[model samples]
Target: MSQLQDNFGRRFHYLRMSVTDVCNFKCTYCLPDGYRPDGKPKFLDLNEIEHLVSAFSQVGTQKIRITGGEPSLRKDFTDIIRIVKDNDKINTIATTTNGYRLAKHAQEWYDAGLRRINISVDSLDPKMFYQITGENKFDDVMRGVDAALEAGFERVKINAVLLKGLNDKDLPRFLHWIKNTPIDLRFIELMETGLGHDYFKAHHLAGNDIKLQLEQAGWQFDTPAVDDGPAQNFSHQDYQGRIGLIMPYAKNFCASCNRLRVSAKGKLHLCLFTENGVDLRDLLQTPDQQAELIERLHGQLAQKKETHFLHDGITGVTQHLASIGG
Candidate 1:
């Protein structure tokens, strides 16, 4: 069994696979424009997804993260999970969802071999969630979070994109709320993503200043925010849960980059900030060419841009975040 190693010698262990780009909520960042549910990719079926995951696992991917505009929207999401577990002995089978439908599917997903779950909760207030996400699924998101914990998943992460002037006021509130909960609340920095100019200009928070505020407020973070993963984790003396800062814009996480993403349409994205990618959908029906696809993916990783150009004054692309599993 070979692992995915680039020319730079960075061995990758994880792949985030977006099952579909269509979503219910037209969030300001992810689907800022809009989407058509009928536009979902049917090119790769459950069997094809399983084959893709197995092929990657054979090439050294240990963790496979199922993502979508909302993975739960798929009626066969659990079927995909079951097939993935049966096809490969992946160390972890995880999924990222908007949490609108997680409440109904969390237990089934856990039984189907899903071990970890990441839910997007932009705000604890419904009004704010609606203001940011353009939907009133805040209660649904909370229900999903509670369901995930009750379902006994190994790790339940609450991912909040930190918009500078918009949601920064809720940091202390989130910190206090997580004290006795099991959620790993993480604050993700607003990235200059393909969502376009309006989204890019929304992020004005500096990672250093944010960290300083957290430190002064009495949170103790032991790990460097830029190490291993994007989030620098913090903990309080009494809080059982952990707080995280994913300073993707303020902290360069490229040095420890260990992930590659495949869009719902079957395009392989080597980096989050780049539009350059190769389509793998055309090769799925030709199983004999799995080796060729693997070679193509590995070759591209060698040329993967060391860091995103967001900090270098480069504007992002036009692809939707829901499409890329970002």
Candidate 2:
């Protein structure tokens, strides 16, 4: 296996694979209403996906996260999980889901060697939930969360996308839920991506703001006592579970970004905010071209932008989060 170090000397070892570009829910933050496409989405076949993962594994990739328009929507999702977990070099296999189908598949996923799961849940209130997701199935998602816990997934995480004047008022209620539930809660800052910029005025919230809100609500912050992702993890002084804040816009983690993303159509993206990507599907069709493709991939990593300028007036290169596999 080959090791590629960034300018900051952080070894890149994680790969995020978007297995599909189809999702069921239309979250206001990601995909707004009245948004339609003229044509079908480009999806990767199982064999092509497996080949790409195998190639990446040969280059020292150890952690692979299965993301999608909604990864759970994929028919061969279990098979995909099995292939990645079967790889001896892959150390972690995780998935970011909408939790719509989690209840039904949680046990199967656990049996297939999946150890981590992140569920995107924006609001806890039923009416606000419908307003955020444009769907009235809040109870279904809650059921899915309970099902995940019942399935014995050791690490279940809830991801909340915070928007000002929206669900921000429910932060305290969200924290209250976290205190009683065993799963970890994460608060994500709204990025100016997809429909976020057009419909929601990037009412960005920083990590410090979240901490302050918790304190004002009478919740004392005690560090979770564990070092994790870019998220700043904390626990209520007497709560059972933990809370995390992902402040991408305010506090950029590009320097410490240890992961790369691959679109469902087989394009290798070096950053979440960049539009340029290396097409690996074309190279895979030509057996004699794998080595050159590998070299080019390494070069892309070297050229990976230091940070994404979402709020810096740069626009129209990176596709919407749905298309880019957020």
Q: In TM-score terms, which candidate is top?
A: 1
CA RMSD, predictions in order? 2.4, 2.7
For model 1, residues 1-326, the per-residue Cα lDDT tens digits are: 56777776677778888887778887877776577665434636875786688678778787888888777777888888887788655778888888988888789899999998888998887888898889888888898899999999988999888777678788778877788997788878776654466756765566666788878979897664311345788878888788788777665567778888887778888887656667887666667878877777777777777777877767456366776778
Report the error of model 1 at residue 294, Å: 2.1
Which residue pairs of candidate 1 clash?
Answer: none
lDDT, residue 225, candidate 2: 20
Compose the digit string of candidate 2's lDDT tens values, residues 191-284.
6764456554645666578877766766555453211456777766577777887777665555567778898888888777747677888766
Worst 10 residues of 1 by lDDT: 222-231
Off-target runs (Cα >4 Å) in candidate 1 are 36-43, 222-228, 316-318
Compared with the true structure, all predictions reach lDDT values of 0.77, 0.77
Estimate TM-scores for all models. 0.92, 0.90
